[model samples]
Target: MNAALALHGLSFNYGDRTVLRLDALTLQPAETCAVIGPSGCGKTTLLHLVAGLLRPTLGTVSVCGQRLDELSVSACDRFRGRNMGIVFQRLHLLPALSVLENLLLAQHLARVSRDGAAANALLDALGIGELARARPAQLSQGQSQRVAIARALVHRPSLLLADEPTSSLDDGNAVRAIELLRTQAQSIGAALLVVTHDRRIRGQLDREVVLGGAA
Candidate 1:
């Protein structure tokens, strides 16, 4: 089978300054790994590259056997929605929409058929079924974080990318959040790549990739 994610000689630049570079990286389906590094080491940049949000200045990125560099802008967006899910550091839930609507919106944007049953099932699995009708502004920090995670996984993406997923949680909630991500990703058979600085989570993953310098 094709690797869930692969990068070769990948490098990204911000104008003349190089921000991130990786000679090679690969993650198999259903595998989990953490990308850890100091500030400005391109941790988040790597996630964006894999998610097709930014193009690499050099080399190639392939997700589920398809080359991201080869896809057009529209194709890339569609591909990302169907194959990848991202939990950004800032949870970008639409405050005006209810929790269930946010997940449905994700499906709508991905061009997938809207399935409210699947959406509600996912919410129930995350232990936030009752909160499905609540708006984002009404949820607590932990509740909001769970909603963001459910939104990412509602589509059953093949590759799951999470940035600083546990950054703001306490010890208890941090562990719970990581477990949720792992369980949900495994259920969907997606390779999981988490970009985080939290030392508390390093031991929980299958392996850890430590990045050094900004190219």
Candidate 2:
């Protein structure tokens, strides 16, 4: 079994404040893993490092067999665009744009042509097709969360990293969001790694890992 994502003695910190002290964590292809821990346990930092959003201060992180430290800035940006999708805790949608527009913008930023039909298909699959024309500010928290998921999956990234994506939803909507994530991950051959403190969702995932430091 090939490991899709791996971390080896990875450590990061802000000045004297230590965060993300991972040691030899790995996830196989097609794996749907849940990361659970208390607040400020370095879950988000780990995700950022895995996604190439941050360079490690020590050790190494790799995804799809590519070592993050070895890639050039431009190469890393392209690699992330072509292979990674992220769902942030804040959703990060543009208030001025409709949901459909927000997704289109993401595709444009990735240098991919905006395919309205495909975008609609993705929205439909995520059960948010009807909300396409709605702006982010107008939707409920649950609705925005679904839109974020749809945007993340629209480009079919091979690795999906989510940070507290479903934390704000009600129980029913939380399950729905997870189901949508699983469906997209399965269809795209993407390994889904979600970081959250929600214990209720543990049994819903195929695997679970705890984030921590040696301290």
Clash count, one per candidate: 0, 0
lDDT of 2 by residue, 81-183 (tens): 8778899998889999999998988888777888889999888887789999999989988888888887887787778888887788888978878887877
Quote the lDDT for 145 in model 2.
85
Worst 10 residues of 2 by lDDT: 206-215
> Which candidate ranks first by lDDT, i.e. highest?
1
lDDT of every model, 2 decimals:
0.91, 0.84
Over 4 Å off in model 2, which ranges?
Answer: 213-215
The true-versus-predicted C-alpha distance at residue 176 of model 1, in Å, is 1.0
Stretches of model 1 off by over 4 angstroms after superposition: 213-215
lDDT score for residue 5 of model 1: 96
- Leading candidate by TM-score: 1
lDDT of 1 by residue, 1-215 (tens): 99999999999999999999889989999999989887678998999899998999999999999999899999999899899999988999999999999999999887788999999999999999999899999999899989999999888888999999998899999999999999889988999999987878877888788887311
